[model samples]
Target: MSAVPLEAVVIGASAGAMEALSALLPALPQNFRLPVFVVVHLPPDRKSLFAEIFQAKCRVPVREAEDKEPIRAGTVYFAPPNYHLLIETGRSIALSSDEPVLYSRPAIDVLFESAADAYGPALAGIILSGANEDGARGLKAVAAAGGVTMIQRPDEAQAPDMPLAALAACPQAHILPVAGIAAFLQAL
Candidate 1:
């Protein structure tokens, strides 16, 4: 941790998102205080079952993010399919139907970058397994804003491209296995 009290967490994952998130989200204790915002690449035409799926496994409340909703502590908010999830300056959720980034609507970069702007040093950004380089710049933005940045170890990822790109963009990020990342979040 950067000695700055973290107010929120932003996590981006793809390819093996379900497995990676399963290992991480379920580990947060029921009393975990920070609100976690997650973006997992999903087909634009399909409905996202992420909130329901993770709700059963996680101790915290899990729900699909709603536009203009106030952020709540200990909640896990998953970006809705086909929309770009953004963190507003007022700490509220904003959904956009804007053109996709890196070929994904709910791009990891979109969420991470917006959250970095909203929380700055009080943010923690995490990049996990994916097939594309969507999160590299976002992780760099978080680091530049003095926020904590973490990436799953490339060797442990189902698809290493995302992690590798992030590492190349922001070498200062903590590189850890899924289990190690889980433990770090639990200690926060």
Candidate 2:
């Protein structure tokens, strides 16, 4: 069992996210109690079908996060295409149109940092395959806040830059392959 009593799990990815998530999300046990938030880079002008696609595959509830929506355990929330998703002090979702970070509107850094503040030591942040360095600092913030941090092993990632950047920024982050990450979450 995990020592942290994780209240939330935050995941960030870019280029190769869909496949990685396909391997990860469907594996969570149906009774898993922690809320999960995900940020995956995508074109802002397009509509997102992430919720529908993942919901069809996952045993747990999956939906696109809405502004002011209450954060609920046992559900997985995905940031919409253009909005930067945040967790407010009241534990409600906040969507922003603020200037994009790292050339991405739904930046992973935004979600991970906000969650690190909201959940503190009870949060777990995971950085996966991507071509950019967007999530590195946010993962560091999670670790600094005493939350658990993880990175998909670089060599195993479909695009290793994001994981490598995260590993460089937060050397202590647990390094796991995608399947290993799923197992770890199940164990938690």
List candidate 2 segments past 4 Å from native: 1-3
Candidate 2 C-alpha error for residue 146, in Å: 0.3
- The TM-score of candidate 1 is 0.99
lDDT of each: 0.94, 0.93
lDDT of 1: 0.94
lDDT of 2 by residue, 85-164 (tens): 99986788999999999999899999999998998888899999999999999999899999999999999899999999
| lDDT (C-alpha) at residue 159 in model 1 | 88
Question: What tens digits encode model 1's per-residue C-alpha lDDT throughout 1-188?
Answer: 78689999999999999989989999999999999999999988988999999999999999999999999999999999999999998999999999999999999889989999999999999999999999999999999999999999999999899999999999999999999989988998
How many angstroms is residue 169 displaced in model 1 relative to the true structure, after the best TM-score fit?
A: 0.7
Candidate 1, clashing residue pairs?
Answer: none
* Candidate 1 displacement at residue 141 in angstroms: 0.4
Listed in order, each prediction's TM-score against the native is: 0.99, 0.97
What is candidate 1's CA lDDT for residue 81? 96
